[model samples]
Target: MRPPTVLQGAPYPYRANSLNLFRLILAGTVLVAHSFYTTGNGEGPHIRGENLGGWAVAGFFVISGFLITRSRLRTSAGEYLLHRIVRIFPAFLVCLVVTAAVFGPVAMLMQYGSLAGYATTPVTPLQFVWSNITLYMNEYSIGRTLSDLPYRSVWNGSLWTLYYEFLCYVMVWLLGALAWFRRSAVLAVLAFVAATAAHALESVINVAGLDGDFLLFLKLAPFFLGGACVHFVIERWGVNPWIGAGAFVVTGALILGVPGWGGQASAPFMAYGLLWLATVVPQPRWIAVNDVSYGFYIYAWPVQQLLALGGLGIGGGALGLIVYNVAAVLLTFVFAWLSWRLIEHPAMSRIRRRVVVPSRTGSAAA
Candidate 1:
């Protein structure tokens, strides 16, 4: 017998795809990758000059770009922006508070025997949370509490990406809202190609004298734009195995052979290949039912940091590494679950209920 293809009999339920589970795995990849360095093991592993965490972040951006572009087309600009903000900000805000109030205080307690003068310390807990309330991550530590950790003075190093992610959201918000762009998603495809070229030649571009400071944004733009391009292709072609396989091959070459900008340049192909895999995999029901990847992502670095302070993420020989990974994974999961149940889920639900998300197809990506 032949197997089914293209998912949901060619209707291709985007919301029903295994993205949730896939995202969770990406989050885990970041966690494990960070575990290497956060635990003082050096930058974990690398592919094409990117650490595992960097690769995972690229993965997140690729997927995110696809879905967000789809979203902008379906909703009013206001609705799109609102959903984006709500989706990212509430949980992020909570995570900041937890870091400043909970994680920092605990670390201080462990190191200094008290939280005395904690609030007044430079980069105080309030300052840490407030300064970064907008998600730019202006402050990385609270009251200098993390000064002793091997990763020193960085509370949640993972968070720097969130600012970039949100910036990408705004990029989609602006570009997708254009009347002409909305009418022709090929614009998205073109934009993606342009970005890909830029990144693929990043080295030559840098040598030619581009501003040094804009490198980080340039590093991520292609992937996000590629995801947008992938969304266009999926809507037009459905999910064919032939094209998907080809995409994977191209993605592999772009990511591995091209180093530096290779990962960024491979964004569209990578996203398409991942989408194809999502359709083929037998995903668990729980991940679909309760999306915890965001929670997991936001909480992972802190969980690792806490472990590092406890001597878990550091110098864990095979045995210690095993224990640290186990304990950190378990603890991060618990926090993620709580964050989803108590904070993220409820806040999103309230915003969703209060707002009528102008949907043309009556279906939305989760």
Candidate 2:
């Protein structure tokens, strides 16, 4: 394919992309990846030190970095935060409540004897209110819910990343408030350096004394910041398909060839690849109109666990896995669609209408 012409010195065209569909596909990727863990004998697929779910999470952070930065730039801080709150919390609160009150109690009754035990458990109410209220500080399970399942007690392992995602949002907002986004190129370079250094440090030194979650945040921060860097690159130099293609080849090679730090090394290239797909890939118009990705992402893990609890994958083999994943995907889609229609979209629309901002001059923010 011929390289698309570069459009330098122009505003970044965020709207001319299929990021919504891209995120949906990524969410589905996570579900598929987790299916191996949730189904059958619960022995997940071993893909040579790589996890598709990890990649999907990385993709999420990248997109969030790019889009949220743009969002913060175009609006007042209050409006920006309002948009973030509405976009994330309402649907999430619903999920938390349902999981804690409905699903948790049901699972507890199935596993134990009565709802009294669940009600008496402090973690139950704490899981519901604390997670929804704090946003990042999450409680995955409520009183032995999903305990009978193979994964055992973890209601939603997928949620840990949401904490980091929210952290990235706050970081972006802080940077924007500090005027770093206005000088995006300089900030991107610094962030890129910091990310690489952190990865290198982790790979070389024994940081065993450090908090595991903090260390993990250090590792994943690169992808998020690398995404922001890519946004700067696109804004400054524009999208050249040849550069993207070259990046893809180099990063793919690194991922395949390098040991230990290959994934971290490939963040920039992956960020670029995501941009290429977002901008250059042709997507169906329907994909652009309805965004069920967030719902799918937030709901899939619990749905998978519920299916497992229901004995959908007892056979312990490929057939069992296929059955479980198919069932999970179908049901998860239904929930996602319902969430979009009933909760997320309406909340966003209402919030947007209530909090009006000045019109931006350049391309529409994604």
Each model's RMSD to truth, in Å?
Answer: 3.7, 3.7
Question: Candidate 1 residues 1-366, lDDT tens each?
Answer: 333454312434676679999999999988988888777877767886678888888889999988888877777788788888888998899999999878888999888899898999888899998999998878887776867887888888788888888888888888975787876667887777777677667788889888743467778888899888877667655677777778889988977787667777788888988888888886799888788999999999998898898887577676887788888888999988988998888877876633344443346533
Steric clashes per prediction: 0, 0
Off by over 4 Å in 1: 1-9, 200-213, 353-362
Question: Clash pairs of candidate 1?
Answer: none
Residue 344 displacement in candidate 1 (angstroms): 1.7
Give the TM-score of each candidate: 0.91, 0.87
lDDT of 2 by residue, 288-353 (tens): 777999999989988888888878866657787778888988999988888999999999888674
